[model samples]
Target: MITKVTHGWRPGGLVAYLMGPGTVEEHVRPRVIASWDGLDEGWQPDTGPGGALDFQLGRLIGALQVPATRAGLPVSGQAPPGRGYVWHCSARLSATDRTLSDEEWAGVARRLLDGAGIATTEDLGGPRWIAVRHADDHIHVAAVLVREDTGRRFWPHHDYRGLRCTARELESELGLTPTALADRTAARRPQRAELELAARQGVEPARTELARVVREAAVAATDPGGFVDLLRGRGYLVELRRLPSGDPIGYKIARRATTPIWFGGGKLAPDLSMPKLITRWGQRGDATERLDAGVLAETRQTLERAERILRGARQGIAAENPDGIAHAVGDVVAALGARYGGALGEAASCYDGAARAPYEPVPDVGSVGSELRTLAGYLLRPRRRHRDDLDALSTVALLVALAALVQQIAQWRAEQGKRHQATAARDAQRLIRCTAEERRPRRGPPRPRYAREVAVDHSRRENAVAAIT
Candidate 1:
């Protein structure tokens, strides 16, 4: 499950977008899962048989607006008059979870809204919202953020994080597959426009590519200087933040030599932060490095190539041609199978080695690997039948699954790199300290006190004889 929350100053446009037929298809009408009114009792709008859809929509919008007007709050300076705080959110279940009924889904939506502190009874005085089920496996909820009786506004604190936590809890309760939680420090992913550009240009998106490069460089380089040089060789412009005395405090990366836009290392990835890197490379000097420049570069290029292949396949799928879809699915299956299989094998090998050590148990990557292989097999022989039997929706699901698997593998590999780097750095530091101790000079044993006094008296007598002569 995933939840997206966004707020605006107007409800009419948002309500229309959710309830309008244009959201799904011209022929398919959206289903009103549930509706409520804060001002009136038994005010469920007529969305039943023989009821006018337009009238129901108007009633829905009116319910959303009445609270804002009754609150008597000033219009948001960011928007024009008659526009107040409108809280819009969507909760989407995985496409595979298609057995849930409209009522069940609505319950999930309500729980999420309440958890996120958006449409709570205490906050709004009453339920003043509507949940619309779209053709897709998702529900859209629109509510007025202003209280109807007290004229108070409700702003959710840390709304995104709250939504994520609620979604995770719901996933467990609903017996759904759990997904990786969002990293608070992770940069905003590439937008749809950037993805489309990458597809059109037949190149990997800059943000994704940059993140991959940064992660690899962070693991392979022995010291901060080496890390900077490694990134420079990879065609990324590196900017280092320094103190007045010329000590590096932080760093950022640009996509190329000429780009003015830069992303902080932490923004690119949590592990790529300057402080994290310093911790990984303790007592940093020229240490024994494991991964060389060639290996790192090759790995990055392979990832980029795979991304390009996936993008091309997605383009073909978008065309909606039967033959094209088959070809696309085959290409994706082939490319991702090899990549994910290799990653899984590597992870398994590392896990085996770590298991021999007395350290904590390594997580079982075998299960994830097995899942990836199963997904690959599904793509290879969908429906246990011929390719001609493949439906568009099934093909789309396969594509989404393939993408998810790829991302999972990438994350696994990144984590493995961090562990390897830490181990290598510790070994290197031990070696350095041992070598320094071996080379250190030693002092001769101290002479006895009587022997030292006799030598001193002899030297003094010789000096007196020379002075007399």
Candidate 2:
């Protein structure tokens, strides 16, 4: 079975919508958490002997509405059959050993459901919590993120890497198998390279590294185009500009490349200043003149420092203090007089090594973003798979490979047919040439045709005559 999980900010503002919608009107009393234990049959009083049918229907609808309740941020409101928000999200269990019976599978799911329910009360950070079984194939758990102290909805302004980490840890505690976790990890997109680079550097780089790299390169570049092209070749995007009014007016120069090269999710500070390049090339002053004196010196220092820190990170210098590397990045950016973009948290989140960096203009060969992201996400939600989990993942891999093989064979056959036709045409041409050079058929000396070519022609003639007769 496939296992996957997806999470993000609750769209459309949770609290307002769920609390506002009158669907759960009868049960929307302002209690912290109202129980449906006795109220199930009451909600839809119809012909039922023991209320079993009513209870089951209520449970399904209530489970579905947990997310809605969670979205609105009012846990006090009732999460009746069809009005709860699905907050924490769902997770699937992968099998490895011999397949268990339907009853055994249900037992595993019940335990997961129990774990999720217990986790909801015990680990009360995210919103509403739920665990659902898809027959015996999988389990889906959804939990809300809310303030435990005040019961107010908590909206995360940025992407929370910590949430993913929490998910991984919970999965592991729930006894998910490694192979199953691996499969789940593979499904998520890889983290950004810049973050990986930062983690490697011992700490994440400050937000300004992207600009500094471009500024320094632009300053020293005799040909800005050539320099930008070089950076692009290295997977960087460079932006050129000009100053319309400053002392450097009419000056053409290379400014900073795009900030947050990858994962430009947040905003930038308005006051931060950057060098401007003239729109019209060869406007007035020398391109070098457009480069600010202080900027050039500072850019050089920043670039050198960035290089040193990058080297240190790669060498695992600050493994003990992840924050150290992050701080250093912040310092480097400040020293270069660069502003942090709106994506600082996202950028910082990327430090987890699971986020995909924005597409680099230049790609670093041999990089593994997906693998690292999987690891990073795994760090968040670890699952300790049982033996059966491992077997299941292997089975899945085999199935995938089998599917790919079928496709490969089809392609190979098409290519082989083309090759066979080409060989036939070549043999026909050679035979024609041999016939053209022939003096007489009876008692004649053989011409010096290549031995292999002669054999191929003879084979073709024999096959042709056989087919005709």
Candidate 3:
């Protein structure tokens, strides 16, 4: 199931829409399924012809707005844009899911409102709200934020997140099609304006083009200067937003065009942001460092170190970070992509979300993280190695270890409620595992996400561990 949240100040407008013909004539038998006042209280009024408003509709709208009205909130006229008295959420079942009965839909609505704290079992007069069913597979939940008993305005804390959790639980309990959790790890989608402009100009959207270039730059460069140089080398325009102290605070990239509209790093992906990306390049050094027989040993050691750090973090409380390994892990994966340039490259791209946590900046790059970054730097150079230098067996061991770390990353992300990120991590890990699976040896069996790692011969792993659980 999927849910979307929206808000407004006018209860009349929302109620009228819910009870009337939908935007696409999709509404079928529009009527109330549930309300803050029980059905016996007549919140659902008779609809006029074609589900249009009538005198009784006024009563229903009045009932919803009473608390706000009593609390001296203006219900009509140009009172102000953000009164936000109206809270609306639309919950829709997947097309393939079983259709829910009206009573079951009511229960779902009640559970969501209770879980979201919009209206709770203990707060009988918390807020006046209703669930309206106009279609078999969905319902619209509308609530006025003003509490009936106290006439005081109520705002559900973190209700958007709350709705997501509740919706997941409801999907499980009601046998609805499961949806991905609302982990903010996904890249920022291009807005309607950007899409429209792109369509008008007959070019790829600026956000899409910029994200591709920025991600490429992020993976290839070892320093801020190199990152900038790589973008410029790619023939894109790069502009740094800096502080008065001559330090770069942020950056924007754009395609070279008559009007080069720019996009910030954050607009590309959370981890792609300058502050976070810079932290991953700790003490920038040569990306073209030679790859030799010892390079295999170094890579294995780096991955093992990261695996151990994550294992410790998992054991620690939720408050502890996995020591910002995400930034460096992205580097490691991207380096593999740069070197291998096939499925590995696609894996690196998919792992982008797994390497980022929502809203959190990458903290200090620890010793292990630094090692991973340096290893990545060495791998980024294309002319660095021969088959004999990093043989198949040793390469398998490194891939296995990297897979284990990504699996642990997936688990950590899942624990942090970042399911989207976890999914991405798993996809990337799958691609990597698939690439190495047939030839992967069976000594040190790959541990599952969040499992205790057993020191074993890296060659002895099974289907490799997944990234971001």
Give TM-scores for every candidate, taking all chains together and pairing residue i with residue i.
0.53, 0.28, 0.68
Error of 1 at 146 (Å): 3.1
Off by over 4 Å in 3: 9-13, 20-25, 50-85, 93-100, 121-127, 146-155, 168-183, 192-205, 232-237, 254-262, 283-288, 293-327, 336-345, 357-368, 378-421, 433-469
- Candidate RMSDs in order: 25.9, 22.6, 13.0
Stretches > 4 Å off in candidate 2: 1-88, 93-126, 147-149, 155-469
Instruction: Give all candidates' CA lDDT scores.
Output: 0.53, 0.33, 0.78
**Local accuracy of candidate 3 as per-residue lDDT tens digits, 129-208:** 88998888889999999887788987889887888889999999988888877756678878889999989989878886
- Report the lDDT tens digits of candidate 1 across residue range 1-469: 8888776876767776765556335424566676554322234345646443442656666656776777774333457555347777888778776557776777777777778776654553753677777556777887777765677777776777778878888888888756545444233477787799779979887776676666556544556898899899878899899889987779988876444457887666444578756654442223222323322232233334444443444444322222122212222333233233433222222221111111212122122222222233233222334332233333333334433434332333234443332232233223323333443345699999999999999999999999999
Which residue pairs collide, candidate 1?
Answer: none
Task: Please report the candidate that would top lDDT against the real structure.
Answer: 3
Q: TM-score winner between 2 and 3, please give it.
A: 3
Count of clashing pairs, candidate 1:
0
Can you write out model 2's per-residue Cα lDDT over 1-469, one digit (the tens) per residue?
2334344344223322322223444222211112112132133323236532222234334543454464453444343454333343334445553344434433443343333342232443434343333233343434444443445544444223333344445456545543212211111233466567568767534344443444333322334455456556656544444455533321122223454443221111111123222111112122222223232232333333433433444465522222222222222222112222332222232221211111111112111211211122221222334232234333233223222322222232234333222232233223322322341224468766798799999999999999999
**Ranking, TM-score, top scorer first:** 3, 1, 2
